[model samples]
Target: MTLPAPLTGVVPPVCTPLTPEGEVDVPSLLGLVDHLVTGGVDALFVLGSSSEAAHLTDSQRRLVVRTVVAHVAGRLPVLAGAIDMTTPRVLDHVAYVVEAGADAVVVTAPFYTRTHPAEIARHYRLVAGRSPVPVIAYDIPVSVHTKLSAELVLELAADGTLAGLKDSSGDLAGFRAVVTGARARAGITGFSALTGSELVVDSALALGADGAVPGLANVDPEGYVRLDRLCRAGDWDAARAEQERLCALYGMTGVGDRARMGASSSGLGAFKAALYLRGVIACPATAQPQVPLSEGEVERVGKHLAAAGLL
Candidate 1:
């Protein structure tokens, strides 16, 4: 099936909300969605890295997807992140979500176990073949340590199975290669690329990317909007400045390790806590095992947000 017009605009990898007792906080989840919508993001990505997809059970993942799909009320495209290391499991999850009415699926390369490039290509092709909707290739080697070569991606794009790709790899050469090659190929009209990292939003856009699927958009959705506007308006200087500002918020969350704190998995706990403190999300509680920030960390984050005018 043909994919939707290359998805443009900011798509935030939304965080999963949890109760004080560590249950999936449906109310808070709904509240966060409303907050993001009000913050002006173009779409919502549930169960992505920022959403802590890795830590959630299959049932929880389905519930989050169904809940967000319902809560969104079709206001925007809700793409579910089906990131599994195995094809059978990923395809099953993909079918489940497509039946749940997800707009698209972001399938990353198999990483739990090593696989060759030919195997990787076949895996995605099979996934796209099974998926009811379009498939978005997710390339975040930092988390999985497995790279989906641009050449393989070009092959998928040529065949029309892979609808789009998200380059979280942070390798400029790789990104440019895929972009240029895809642009030159046939039946790749719907293929799009997104920068998983916020720092490269401007640069990625310059390289013909659709937009970004950034973690920072959880806290600063409007900032992403501003960056997109600046870039599209040809003001790279302003866009770069906004990118730096967003990175500052990321710094408060503690860079790489901070994103994996406690049972939170992807810093969603800290992000929610900061939002709760700012009165954005009513419940600051995270899933069990996800330790909320220490008093000092919260204080420092508060100072940072205030300094950045987020508070």
Candidate 2:
């Protein structure tokens, strides 16, 4: 399906289900897709940070975009992450995913090599010029080590190099600047300003954000969808209550043992384990090199699910 301009509502950054030996588990992956569709997500964002796009082999990333696009059958937009270290590498992944039928591609600022603001602008313009579909700039400073300034984003949006932004920079002030800029900029119609902050969807929407790309929405999409609705409906009190509940449930990410693993292992592992416990996927295994959650951690995930009435 062609993506709607200013894509709105809940778009989950999907998880990549892995086999015990670390290959993509196609069946489980499909199952998780169905779960999200059924749960009422507006769109599916595959090969994103939640999906471990950086860790997946090129072949694996291709398989993921192809499988999801085929199975979805255009029910909704499928956004593939063309995440790589530089513009040339990102362009290669972009070619693969669009060929595989992705509706749009998500990319971050160049990494592994220090870059300048001028270089960043050139990179995105080059990408947008070549891409067959819309390119959403992913502002994930935590991963890329370079925060996309509000001025730079506005300049890009004005010239149409970026169709949208996925702001994971955790700078609401900067996010608000983009949100307001998108509105005031003449002829910049249908510019999606989506937040990657799962913790602040209500606030984001309240401040004119087009939508959210919350990783937590993978486990309870209905909650995020409901939050989106409540925000749109101008029911701020109700939205706040609901967003708080989900935020509380999000505390499950802390269950994984910190000393033994990194944030990815803890956060992604907890989400997969919760899905397995909820009977969505056959297994909770994450890709290799990321430690699996211990039995104790799994139990903690269950408790979070139960507390959220997902168990």
Candidate 3:
């Protein structure tokens, strides 16, 4: 199917559930999808950073896209994250997502290389030019160590092939530039600018962002739903308060620690622990990506939830 319009509002980057045997736990994943939808999310973002896409195999990634599409069943748009360091690989993954009936694809510019602004434009152009579905440019400076500059994004915007953007860089300057560029395009349905930063959800919204795709939404669905409602109703003060609460809730997950694993198995382990502590999903999704969280860390997560009134 062709993609739906550029997405808005909260799109939870779902966690991939794995059995104790380290297999993709289809049942658990489906259950989480249902919970998130019922919890009032506007869309689903699968195979994203929070979903541990790097740890999943090619076959598993395809399965995830398929499972989420089936679970959503057209109730909401499903944007599959295309996590690859190479252009060809990302294109191939985008093809798979479209064939599996995803609504759009989220791709960060080529990582591991110091990509130039022109190369960034070409990368997004090539993906959007070749893909059967719409594309959402994902710019997460922390994970990829590469940024999709607004100037480059605007250059691609002229092509009308780019679907929109998911700005995970968390920099207000970067966010402002993208929104400003997108706003100038008359034909474009306002290029989607999604904030990955929970701390800036309201500010981003106030600054003309379409919405957000926060990792914190996984732990505090009720809070995010409230925030979304408040923002939509133009209650910036209330929304900002709720966004701060979400940032506090996400602080429990040890966000800074995941970067230390440096492509090891331990990275995925800590994420699963956060979800477990929040009672969003059970533990042992996969031991291959990272080692299990220590007892102290796990207990700390519990205290975090209790302190935040999440438990």
Model 1 lDDT, full chain set: 0.81
Model 1 agreement with the true structure over 126-155: per-residue lDDT tens digits? 998888788898998888888888888888
lDDT of 3 by residue, 136-202 (tens): 8888888888877777777676677577888888678988988877888666564677888767788
Residue 221 in model 1: lDDT: 85
The residue-by-residue lDDT of candidate 2 on 1-311, one tens digit each, is: 78899899999999998888889999999999999999898999999999988889999999999999999999999999999998899999999999999999999999999999999999999999999999999999999999999889989988988889999999999999999988998868889999999899999999999999999888999999999999999999999999999999999999988898999999999999988998888889998789999998999999999999897
Model 1 error, position 232 (Å): 0.9
Q: What is the TM-score of each candidate against the true structure?
A: 0.92, 0.99, 0.90
- Residue 109's lDDT within candidate 3 is 83
Give the better candidate number (2 or 3) by TM-score: 2
Question: Model 1: how far is 237 from its true place, Å?
Answer: 2.5
Quick one: ranking by TM-score, best first?
2, 1, 3
Off by over 4 Å in 2: none
Give the lDDT of residue 97 in candidate 3: 88
Q: What is the lDDT of residue 148 in candidate 3?
A: 75
In terms of TM-score, the best-performing candidate is: 2
**Among all windows of ten consecutive residues in candidate 3, which has the lowest summed lDDT?**
259-268
